[model samples]
Target: MINNTIVQELIHEIVKEEEGVPVVECLMEGSITDEEIAEKTHLKLNTVRKILYKLYDAGIASYKRSKDPETQWYTYTWKFESEKIEEIIKKRNQEIIENLREMLAFEENNMFFACKNGHYRYTFDEAAENNFRCPECQEELEYMDNSEIIQQLKRELSLYENNGSEIAFNFKSYS
Candidate 1:
């Protein structure tokens, strides 16, 4: 039933696959002790604890601490917050969409010039201030056509807007 790829990738983001995925899987089973997680995942106790703490810090995992009365040692029981995980992903996607919108607006508003040597890019004001020459390479700056870039941003923005947060992530490491 753990079919959420976003949760999987979020865990992969919290720590390396060697540690993160297994720890997250164990936590998803229900509240579990670090020792139990290590035993189930076949990872070192310390490694499991580390991954758990990282997930905790990321707001997708939480732990309950209790004192073992006879042993006088603290025990921690950890659980994965599936709801919080989805919230984090949606917030991240919204941030990405906002950034893309800002980029599209800037692209639509600006006239850009770039050096032939590809050393610099400047807006109209900067290019005019420098006499349309590359300050770094002393090459004449040429008008840069950004139509393709604008089109690409538009396409990407449209995808996010239409699909909401359920679109596939381009997380190269996880995917």
Candidate 2:
């Protein structure tokens, strides 16, 4: 199963193309020059450059460039920033938790009514004002039970809260 981090998914997709490639293995070791990465991975120089650029754009990779005095050529040393991936995972989980809070509040606050035809839903005030009739079907509007949905949201929020901290701790240790 895929984890929640976007970084993980992107890395997975890239590594899936070729197993035991140097682009990934060498970077995973530590900081490595692009040329070294290409040589070690047996991948074309252009392919290694493309991979580094892609990771750099995603903030999961970083590089430092230096000019060679003798050759007058620029050298770029790249490193995989595992910390950045952990940060992204935290951000994604936080956003998910915040959205869950907003949805739970909305679901728990309003009293909704739905028609027997299962069409549209309205708040209690709207249903009362509309004579408890469905706007489209004109049938009686009954109370909508949202407890199940609210419970589900609660469960999701709890999962994020509980898992986020543990994941952060393990990520730090691994880094």
C-alpha displacement of 12 in model 1, angstroms?
Answer: 1.6
Q: State the C-alpha lDDT per candidate.
A: 0.81, 0.79
Global CA lDDT of candidate 2, please? 0.79
Tens digits of per-residue lDDT, candidate 1, 46-165, equal: 888888888889888899999999999999999988667656777877888899999999999999999999897899999999999999988999999999999999999997786563
Best of the candidates, TM-score? 1
Worst 10 residues of 1 by lDDT: 166-175
Q: In model 1, where do residues sit more than 4 Å from their true spots?
A: 1-3, 165-175
lDDT (Cα, 0-100) at 141 in candidate 2: 95
* TM-score of candidate 2 against the unseen true structure: 0.72
Scored against the true structure, residue 58 in model 2 reaches a CA lDDT of: 67
TM-score of each model, in listed order: 0.90, 0.72
Worst ten in a row by lDDT for model 2: 1-10
lDDT of 1: 0.81
